[model samples]
Target: MRVLVIGGTGFIGQHLVACLVRAGHAVHVPTRRYQKGRNLLVFPTLTLFEADVHDDAVLERLLSETDAVVNLVGVLHSKPGRPYGIEFERAHVELPRRIAAACRKIGVRRLLHVSALGADAQGPSGYQRSKAAGEEAVRAEFSTYSEGALTIFRPSVVFGREDNFMNLFARLARWLPVIPLAGAGARLQPVYVRDVAAAMANALENSQTYGKTYTVAGVSQYTLAELARLAAKWSGRPRPVLPVPHFVGYAQALLFEFLPGRPLMSRDNLDSLKVDNVSDEAMAPELGVVPTPLESVAPSYLRGGKPDRGPVH
Candidate 1:
């Protein structure tokens, strides 16, 4: 299979690309900057195209020789708005719509879209709402095409060695004496990055996954405070977590929002944490994958051992 992967340069993307490559699929990854994809260059099956993926012409050209498309493009923070902010609309909503359109136009039928676990149309945060809108756009756009198939994957917070979730907490625990956290009681099922990558690859080959929405989660669930504590424990620097009140959490997020670059936490993030990120229905088993536990995988990387880059098989 010839797969065109948008947003294939990030943490999850790298793992997914490696899986696809190992499976002998020719993968095309487009990036605005080639230097960002240096790690992916080692894969012989991957060809990195340095271009703006949002451009219609560029996207169509990439889709021309592709058998399927994987849309992993997502944004964590955005300027606040009603339906969604401009950045969220562009990345979460507009981008999926564009990808679906491009895939249909170029005669590509299969699309595997990565959405968030807590995404809902009436969700509290702009991120969740925008993600819901993105799912809608893909479904609507592909509904008309008889040959088109859209597989949407909604995974809980994904964690691995290169992940921003556990690693961020681990780093904080290592450096800081005490951890001041928000959404301490919020529950989340942290799936391993490798499991997610495997699920995406499996969906691409398995026709049963088409036109279905799958919720990919880990074997166990944990609270935000518990996750922080686990991170600290794994990193061998267990710190006391002080869970702040909702108002105080929002205030802390507001302060971080003004900080340079991406905020450590934003009010929108707090809004997302309002909902528990656990799945009622398990999708990994359907994809022939037994979900990896966070405890089994995180300790290998966080505790200074060789990172587990093993395939789901």
Candidate 2:
């Protein structure tokens, strides 16, 4: 299959592209800068196109030869809004709608969209709400395209060697004597990046996955505090976790929002933690994948090495 992977330069996108390439699919990735996607250049089956994905002409031309589309574009932080902020609206909502429209216009049928696990239309956070809206837009557009199907994957916090989740905590623990954390009690099922990529690859070939929403999660669930502790331990820098109160956490997030570059945490992110990010056991198996456990994969990666194989049940 000829697959056009949007956001292929990102963490999860890189893994997914590798999976697709290994599966013998011709993968085309678009990036603003070619240098950013240089890591993917090793894959002979993969091609990186320098173009802005948001431009309709660019997307249409890409879809012309594309057989399947995988939309992995997402934003963790946004300014602020009623339903969602401008960044969220553009990346989460607008892009999916445009991609769907372009896919339909170009007669490309299959779409695999990666969304957040706790996404809800009336969710507490702008990020979640925007994700929900994006799902709606994709579904609405693809429902009319009788020739193709849309598969939506709502994954919990994804972790791997290149992940920002565990690695961030590990980095923080390495420097800080004691870690002050927000949403300490928030439950999350941290799925492996490769597992997610495998699921997407499976979905691409499985027609049963089309028009179905799969909640991708790991086997074990852990609290935010637990995850932090695990990261610290794995990195050989065990630190005490200080769970901040909700108000204090919000204040901390607010302060981080003003920090240079992307904030470590935002108010919307704090709100998103209010919901548990777990999935039913049946979700991954629905796509013929046994979700990887955090314990099996995190230790190998967090310790500064890649795993020899995917996690076992």
Candidate 3:
């Protein structure tokens, strides 16, 4: 299989590309800059495609050469809008729409789209609402196809060595004396990045996952505060988490929004946390994926690794 993974240079995309290569599938990964995806050259079956995917002609040209497509393009923050932010509408809603329609036009039968687990039309955050709209757009475009033609995976907070979620907390624990938190009671079942990547890679050819909306999550659920404490403990920085009121957190996020490049926590992020991300569905039976717990992989990275900020939400 020759696979085209849009947003293939990012965290989950990198993992998915590697997985596809190991599975003996040739992969095409596009990036605005050639050097951004250069590390992927280590994978024998992977090709780095340098071009702007937002361009219609370029996207069509890229899709024309692939057997299937996986759309993992998403943005954590965007300029505010009615239903969602401008970036969210573009990355989450419009990009998927374009990919699905183009794939159909190019005679591509398989598409795997990654959406957020808590995505809802009526959700609190623009990210959630935009993600929901993206899914609808894909389904509407591929409506004429059979069930397995378009598969969507809604994964909860993804965490791994390079993730921003737990690693952010670990970084805070390392530098700050006490962590002031918002949405401290928010519930989340974080899926490992590897598991999330594997589920999407495996779903590409699985008949059971075709046309299905799956909730990909971990084996255990944790509250934001509890997870913070655990991150602190694992990172060897024991610190108390100060749980503030929602208003306080929102106020803090508002302030963060003004601080520049990728706010520590945006107002929309707090809105997202308002909804619990726990899923009752299991990926093992659905996508043949076995979820990895946070305890198993988090400690290794948190204790000794540098807490670099990652772009994956």
* Best candidate (score: lDDT): 1
Candidate 3 global CA lDDT score: 0.87
Model 2 lDDT vs. the true structure?
Answer: 0.88
* Candidate 3 residue pairs in clash (backbone atoms < 3 Å): 148-210
TM-score of every candidate = 0.97, 0.96, 0.95
**Local error of candidate 2 at residue 204 (angstroms):** 0.4
lDDT of candidate 3 over 110-181, digit per residue (tens)? 999999999899999999999999999999999965532988989999888878888899899988999999
Better of 2 and 3 by TM-score: 2
Residue 95, candidate 3: alpha-carbon lDDT: 91
lDDT of each: 0.89, 0.88, 0.87
Best by TM-score: 1
Please give the TM-score that candidate 3 achieves against the real structure. Answer: 0.95
Taking every candidate in turn, the Cα RMSD to the unseen true structure, in Å, is 1.5, 2.2, 2.9
lDDT of 2 by residue, 218-297 (tens): 88889999999999999888999999998999998899999899998899999999988877655555576777778887
Question: Which window of 10 residues has the lowest lDDT sum in candidate 3?
Answer: 304-313
Residue 23 lDDT (model 2): 84
Give the alpha carbon lDDT tens digit for every residue of 1-313 in model 1.
9999998998788889988998899999999899999878888888997989888998898899899999999999999998889999999999999999888888999999999998999999999999999999999889988999889999899988788898888989988999888889999999988889988887788978878999999999899999999899989999989898889999988999998989988899999999998976876555878888888879878887866853322
Candidate 1 residue-wise lDDT at 197: 92
